[model samples]
Target: MTLQQRVNELVRACFAGIWIESHEHTDAIAELAGMCRDEQWRLVTWDIERGLRGPSGSPSEHDAGDPLAAVRAISSLADGETPAIVVLQNFHRFMQSAEIVQALAHAIHDGKQRRGFVVVLSPVVQLPVELEKLFVTVEHALPDRQQLLEVAAGIATEDDEMPEDAQLDAVLDAAAGLTRYEAEGAFSLSLVRDGVLAPSTIWELKTQAVQKSGLLSIHRGAETFDSLGGLDALKAFTRRAMMNRRSDGQAVRPRGVMLLSPPGCGKSEFCKCLGNEVGRPVLTLDVGSLMGSLVGQSEERTRQALQTVDAMAPCVLMIDEVEKAFAGSASGGVNDSGVSSRMMGTFLTWLNDHASDVFVVCTANDVQRLPPEFSRAERFDGVFFVDLPGREQKDAIWALYRQRYDIDLSETCPADDQWTGAEIKSCCRLAALLDVPLTQAATNVVPVAVTSAESIDRLRQWADGRCLSADTPGFFRKEVNSGKRRRRVTTKPSVN
Candidate 1:
């Protein structure tokens, strides 16, 4: 339901205090006013600039922008039996004052009998401890595709200024997760520059919006599955999953995968490329950035960030190095007073229950640090383990990077045993950068397999028969060749 509908029900049921979380105050207030007008209820608004506004649209400066006075006057604004609503704009700013908190608490408690409703409208919810029990939060969601189309119609006056069917769908897709105000600005800007409502212009603005929030960073690069080699099973699985997804949600959608691989493997690269492959934007979420200094701030930031992720639906959400992100959750709140645990709980709940078309891609180098419940069934479509590249996969990876670095085809590669795709790319890049032979460049590069062999072996042993294979369809199996040497990689033409 919309914000107005939700608020309408709560007010009629005599919910004394309501909190509206919104970024666009003007639009929210307009909707509330319209609802109140239709219901024949008294509506009053207050802000720092405009102390008080009654149903008559006149400002009451008697309170002189004092929040305590404004809250106290809410009951007086109501008729004998008519429900009166006082929307204090940005009321979270004054929550720190003990006097304001007390006044709000008493006002909300007494409002139960007097039919007085106090609503706090702000971008964030920061309820003081005393008033927390009395208030219920209602989020003002961003516009959906249909509403966004109406917005595009308002901006694109000329028929030529609007795009055709498929192009219009792209435009609506780009406008998702944006507020009505932001959508208008983006649509107008797109018309001015491209002469039509285009997705590219709106995408650029959306990227800026994501960056400004400091929650997630969006990647809309040209990289696709063609850029890398190996992980045939993974690539095919994701592509098929995308194809099978029904936009109407009639069928079970792809829940995404948990990628467990050693460092320098292609886990992160595969996630970045999946976006371009499926025509979705990849949103990289850094959990460390969600931490806050104040109490309950981290959890709130986590929820807000995930909400933003959900709003930008039909997209990929990648959480890199996730094992370290929620490490504190594993220790049962022994670290940092359970902040990390709470944050992880919020994320886990969202992961298991969110209905958005978000294909989550979480990469982990160490599975030991992750909570066991995280990898449980239904949370992810599958847990796929990416091991070191085999002979054929290595050949394909080497060929792609060699072409990228402009290396000669006849040149032979140095002995490469247990090398990851990233290591091979690094060797090729170093060979081009140093103007040396591939063999000589290989001398300067040390593979993670050699550096962390013990840990990598243990990880492989644990994943054997437990996780799905990225290169094959069945469960992953260890080669069991500890007594023998791995095959040395040489310059060979790849079949793929």
Candidate 2:
């Protein structure tokens, strides 16, 4: 529901305390003012800078800048028939004081009888224990596509400055998560730099916004599907799934895919390339980075990070080495005091229920360590197994790396059985850096298939019938060698 509708319902129900979590205070106040005006109710606004002011441009009778007095004065503006709403801007700043807390608690309790309401408007919800039960928290949503279009149009008044259709859609997508003020600034800045409304400047400013949160980092690179070799099946599946739209022309976004593979496979590279292939920005989410030192902080950070990911929709969210990120989720709090478990729960819920256009690509070297619930049907569109590169795949990988590192393609390649794409790249890099032949560089590299032989074998065995093949269609099947051996006969003695 819109902010005005929610607030109107709560006010009509005589909910004494309403907490609005919003970063755009001015926009929120303007909305509240409109709602009050429509309902013919009295509206008063309070802030540290403005003290307390009514619609008539008059100050309240209470002492200036005193939160306790503000709370007590809320009842004076209301009558038995008419309702009054006193908006407390940044009131969370004063929620720490015992006096303010007690006064708020009393005001909320007495407000219902007098048809008076105390609305706390702040960017974050920091209600004290005393008033926690009394206040109902609501989020003021970030502007949607239509609203953002209006914002862009408002700034770009000139005929040539405005974009239309697809170009306009791109601009709105870039401005999706920004608040009203930020969007206005971004639109204005776009006009200043590009002489027209475009996505470049908005994206530049968006990078700064993401950096400030310290939760998500934007992945900017020129890596595309052509840069990587193999994974044709995986690539085709993702492209088709992501491009599928509803009958109404809306995108029917795929949930995501869980990539299970040994080290050196192209899981991480494929994820990055997928973003470029689909024309979406890749957002790298570091789950370890979201863990906070204080209690409840980790969960809050997880929620915020996920929310940010949702805001940056029509994008890819890549979580590398996801197994290590939620290592102790299944330990039942025996390790790390249940922080990992709670965070995992929040993530799992979102994975299953989120309706955003984000395509989550989680790469894990060891799926054995991941919780079973993580790979369930609805959590991801598919669970794909990226085994060691086959002969054809290895040949393509070798050719690509050869060109990339300026290696001589005519030279003989070393024996690369069980080698992955990464190992091949490493061989080429080492050959170029050391000015050695590919065969010589091979001696310095030990493929993960050999280093982690037992683990890789176990993984292949588990995925044999369970996971989809990253290279080919249908379920993955481990190739088994027949036991027949070839025998050599001596011709001279006819020993055979």
Candidate 3:
């Protein structure tokens, strides 16, 4: 349910303490305060020093510093025959007190008989076991597109003319993922910087908003589809999936795609390039950076990061090599004391239920290492197995590297060496610096296929019929042709 509906329901259900978990503290308080006023509930305020304040903004004759006084104030509202909402600001600190605990429990039971309610407002969440069962928790979301637009419109006094549909969308898109107050600050900043609303100014403000989180950053890297060579099937699939929503006018599909294959096969690069093709910024999520010392803190951090990505919807969220983040946790071992499992669970839930336009692009090196549930159908649009770069793919890779490093590839011809695209690029780069031809640069280099030939062959054998080949039919067909030729040659010699 939406935050407002949830609060209304909680109040109607006679819930005494409502714990709102959110980063948009000011906006939440303002919205809840307004909601209380609309519901005709008498409003009361509280803090550590000030126990409670009445609707008149009048200080109590009591010292206003005791927890018991706050409970008594709630009781006083019931005696006056008026429904009351007691907003306890920063009262979470006093929750550990035994007397306060019993008092709150007693107040909740007592308030249900009358028009009295308790609202706990705290910047941080610190619920003890005893209060967990008593309080109802809800998350106060940051400002969405409509809300941001309203804020922007409110500040535009001089140029009352509304922004064009496309420009307005762009402005809202940039303003997304920011809280109401933050969006207001950004809107004001934009007006002051440019004297009018502009898309560029919104972007500058968005950068600030993302920087404030430090969990997720708004990336501006431009990687075009043309930059990637070969893998036409994968490219076509990506293009189709991205445009599916626009063409059919349907709600975008749930889940994203997982690109799995050997290392250095352009999985990460393909993910990066998709953002450019789709005309959306890319945000990279580094899972390792989320771990924390406190219990549940890591999960909270992950939620915050994903929330940021959701705020910046209609963008690519790239989790490069996610296997490193969640591997072998299914065994339920205590290596990290189940932190990995909790982290994985949090991510999986988001992947399944996330309805936003955030397109997740997760790349993994070893499918064996990845949790099986992650590769299941519907979780991702498709699971592409990127095999070793064939000879044709290698040629295209070489051309790209040659252009990248200004190398004269005409002098160095590619052969049947098992060099991946990344290795080939590295060879070319080294060749340029050493003043040697690209062929010589590869003399000391060994690719994964060579060092781990058995494993590569096993992967290839497993994928032979099950997975789609990235290379053209001509290359794979050659193996069949050669086998046929060998059978014919042996049979003919026996007949003769």
Best by TM-score: 1
Off by over 4 Å in 3: 48-80, 90-102, 160-162, 245-248, 251-254, 413-416, 433-436, 470-496
Task: Output the lDDT of residue 484, model 1.
Answer: 68
List where candidate 1 sits over 4 angstroms from the true fold. Answer: 55-57, 61-63, 245-250, 482-496
Model 3 lDDT-worst window of ten = 486-495
Model 1 residue 81 CA deviation (Å) reads 1.4
Model with the higher lDDT, candidate 1 or 2: 1
Q: Which 10 successive residues of model 2 have the least lDDT summed? A: 486-495
Model 2, stretches more than 4 Å misplaced? 56-58, 245-251, 483-496
| Whole-model lDDT values for every prediction | 0.89, 0.87, 0.73
RMSD of each: 4.1, 6.6, 5.8
TM-score pick, better of 1 and 3 = 1
TM-score of every candidate relative to the true structure: 0.95, 0.92, 0.86
lDDT of 3 by residue, 71-125 (tens): 6667666643556778777777788788888788777777878767877777567
Looking at model 3, the pairs that clash are 51-64
Model 1, backbone clash pairs (residues 3+ apart or across chains), number: 0
